[model samples]
Target: MRILVAPDKFAGTLSAVEAADAIAEGWSRTDPEADVVTVPMADGGPGFIEVLHASLGGELLAVTVRGPLGDPVPAAVLKVGETAYIESAQACGLVFLPTEADGRTPRPGVAAQASTYGVGELIAAAIDAGARRVVIGLGGSGTNDAGAGMLAALGASSEPVKAMTSGPEGLAHVASVDVEPARERLAGVELVAASDVDNPLLGLRGATNVFGEQKGFVGDDAKLAADAALTTFAEAAGRKVADAKGAGAAGGLGYGILLVGGRREPGFATVAAAVGLPDLVATSDVVVTGEGKLDWQSMNGKVPVGVAGLAGSALRPCIAMAGAVQVGNRELRANGIEAAYSLVDIVGTEESFAHPARSLAAVAERVAKTWSRR
Candidate 1:
């Protein structure tokens, strides 16, 4: 039996590379002689740079950039040839958001105050390193400032620089925006916004309403204010991409990318091409893909679904192994997955969280018992 294992990061636990290794280990335990090929995947999220670096063997340029709360954070850019791959989560990820003084997780107020200034810094660093094309992975952000902080960092002028880059509270006070300097800074450079999300920059299905609750914009009042603040910022900038497919990605970081003439591409597609996923799927006997959770969002250009689609197109059986499987069997079938296995279902929630790699391996072993023809 030949099996191909490809998975995204399991959220806070296993990275895509680790998850693929665990799955390969367990499958081999079930069928020691089976041929196993492992490929880590990402959809422009936390593991974007790591996965690309692993597959492409790029020059990893390390740098320190401002975090969401103005603190310094370690980050890296992957420069392959003339193209640079940057993961935005390193600078403003939800995991980096600071907790309250009471030791509780950040609330809407704190999320509202987060910034994306570091992303601009990373882009600048990539440019300085002689990258003619920069591909920015936009997801897992902690800020809700509509990329105002990033714009400010990239040389966009506003009435009060501090307020313009200080998150929503300061955004509410902003008046005008000049993006000429920022545009000039990127002259002769190509920018690509790599993301899975397609939400607009504002309104019901937009960033603030669709993804705000997870980042702390919970109440109606808070969402309204956030939307209004971003609206004011957008009007000031005079850029017309609020309704663009990925304009709401990474808390409006997509909008900022568009404002600077960046084109949007599906993050999964970008990674898939880099990793030669299509060729691998066509030649593999069985395909296995996974992530932290298999939910409605998994259908939205995420790694697992994208892999499954390729497997299906190649007439190969595709299976999914996830930390938790929330989608129904019908949905799984609709998405081209032959079956879905969950670590939580096999080992329970406690063990799954405590030993993610082990639990995932165990699940893969059991799955192999059913699928391994060897």
Candidate 2:
């Protein structure tokens, strides 16, 4: 029997690579003779580069860039041939935001001020490395500035550059934007905005309204202010692409990319094509894909659902293993997941959270007892 294990990062606990390894180890315990193939997955989020590096064998060029708070942060660019892959999370992810005294809650007020200047620095590094094509993975962001800082760092000028380099709050004060220089900077390069969501840049389904709270916009007043600021920036910048699919991704970084001639693509699809996942699913007898959580959001172009689509197309049985399962079996089946298993169910929530790899492995072992045909 042959099994394919592919999973995205388990958020705070396990990376995509670690989750894949744990699943493979546990499945082997129950079916030692079974052939297991592991593939780590990402949806343009925190583990984007790591997963791609594993499958593409690229050169990782390390660089230091500004973080969301204007401090230096470590990041890397993956160069494979003439193309460069960059994870936006490395520069402005929520993980990098300063937290409160509790060490978990993101510090307040920063949400409205978090900047994506570092993302632009990473792009500069990629261009400097001779990359003719750049693919930017946009998700898990901490900023709500609509990529104003990114445009500034790339030579787009605004009245009082400081206002533009700052976050949404600052953009509200800016009067005009000149993006021609930024466009000229990428004259010969092809830019691709790889995003997990297809939201537009404004309105209820947009950036500030839908994603600002997680970044620390606490109340309706704060959200409204941020939205207004983003609207002001959008007016100054180009509003032509504000409604484009993925324009709201990574706090409107997708809009910024479009302003500079970048095209949008589904992050999972981009990774899948690069890793040749369709062929892998076609040859496998069973496909197992998962993530940290299985919920309504999982149905929306996340890694697990993306993998299920591939498995469905290939006529393979696909199951999901998540740390916590919130969706019922009926909904899971509707999404192409034949069956679903959760680590929190097999082991207690405490044990699962405290030792994710071990807990997940235990769940996989139990699943193998029932699913393994050998």
Candidate 2 regions exceeding 4 Å error are none
TM-score of 2: 0.98
lDDT of 1 by residue, 171-205 (tens): 88887788889999999999999998988999999
Model number with the top lDDT: 2
Over 123-174, each residue of candidate 2 has an lDDT whose tens digit, in order, gives: 9999999999999999999998888888888999998668878898899898
Error of 2 at 354 (Å): 1.8
Summing lDDT over every window of 10 consecutive residues in candidate 1, give the lowest-scoring window. Answer: 99-108
Which clashing pairs does model 1 show? Answer: none
lDDT (Cα) of model 2: 0.92
